[model samples]
Target: MEENHRLQVIEEGPYADPGRYRRLVGRLVYLTVTCPDLTYVIHILAQFLKKPQVKHWEAALRVVHYLKGCPGQGILLTANTDLTLSSYCDADYQTCPRTRRSLSGYVILLGGSPIAWKIKKQKTVSLSSAEAEYRAMRYTTGELKWEHELLSYFGVRHDTAIPLFCDNQAALHIAANPFFHERTKHIDADCHFVRDALKAGLIATFKIHTSNQVADIFTKSLGGPPFSYLLRKLGIRDLHALT
Candidate 1:
């Protein structure tokens, strides 16, 4: 399986049937329980389930090849790190070529290691970059709230609000203030819940420059250097190193 993942099986002859391709992708997705790194790639590939082309197959194969080359990669939860919660939020504005919808992504850290992360397409189209970012922040806030509740159930009490980092200044401003303008009036009421959370001190928003936005890797495809950099920043290391 490792060897197959590493080999770039180029598409040849007729395209694979959509049903078969969907099944293969479904099986791969089930593996995400232990392979979060594959989440974004698989989700992106799943978009073409209805009409997968040879090019799409090649792309999926590349993801498998990436996994094969780094077979020992996995998440680790250490006892030594602090338990304070911090989150990074980001979005790709209108990245979907087919739907023109933005993608929202976030990573939550328990101390310095990643504990939760996700990449999902926004349900509605955003009119501006700030709007897209705000939507992303909302999603991250929801995740943080859920994590907070789960920890409480385990008798772990976190007294303070989680600090969420974002690259967009305008989005940060919007979250800090409740007054809505004509520009922001069109945003759905549900998505604006983050604003209330910010006002109530349930979550805090901090500005981070694009260079330091670790969630960037989840929102879109990046170059080799940036991609590797963000992965390390998220505290993902070779699993073999510990063994």
Candidate 2:
């Protein structure tokens, strides 16, 4: 969690055991459902799944060690909170070392508590950062629809348009503009879906500064201060001690 720390594929020799590496990675993946802070790190480790190396194993161990040191960390919730949904979406363009695909992530908050979040690689390569971010916003918008259905099953009504935040202004423009620009000419199906959502009033897109983009944590490795700041913004609580 140091400033600008990055995990790279290092293959000095064979890993002690490929099986153990997979097992550890699997556990970490499951941990991500509750431990949002671990999502980006686990995604990095997963790239070398078939043939993990010494450095990958060591990096995985670091996540485990950090968890051991902060066992009391967890998502905090409030009863009878507002049922409205709001999401922050972001993308790291061409972050995948192997495929050069963009990394997309979104964090959805219900009544100000994180109810759903995901860290995924984009299905196709993005030619621009705005395209990658717009794709991420569409993914978040689709998730909002599913989540609204889930809420309905439990007698909760989420009829209002969900607010979606992004750090890229061009992506927001792409989501609402009826006219296409040469810059967005080659965009994929996701761009159309997001524009449709915006026109249909299913989601509201807004521009936010990079520092306040909580979804940033889910997309890449961050320094300790910023990482801790975003975790707090997501309502993740530390029961063991003060921040």
Winner by TM-score: 2
Q: On a 0 to 100 scale, what is the lDDT of residue 122 in model 1?
A: 95
For model 1, residues 35-61, the per-residue Cα lDDT tens digits are: 656767787777667777776667777
**What TM-score fits each model?**
0.88, 0.93
State residue 196's C-alpha deviation in candidate 1, in Å. 1.9
lDDT, candidate 2, 1-243, per-residue tens: 443444553557768798999999998898887888888888888877888888778888988899998999999897878778899999999987767899999999999899899988988888989889888888898998898789899998877788999999989887777877787776756778887877777788888999999999988888878888999999998898875
CA lDDT, candidate 2, residue 81? 83
Clashes per candidate (backbone, < 3 Å): 1, 0
lDDT of each: 0.78, 0.86
Instruction: List ranges where model 1 is wrong by over 4 Å.
Output: 1-14, 188-192, 241-243
Model 2 residue 193 distance off true place after TM-score fit, in angstroms: 1.3
Candidate 2, residue 234: the lDDT equals: 95
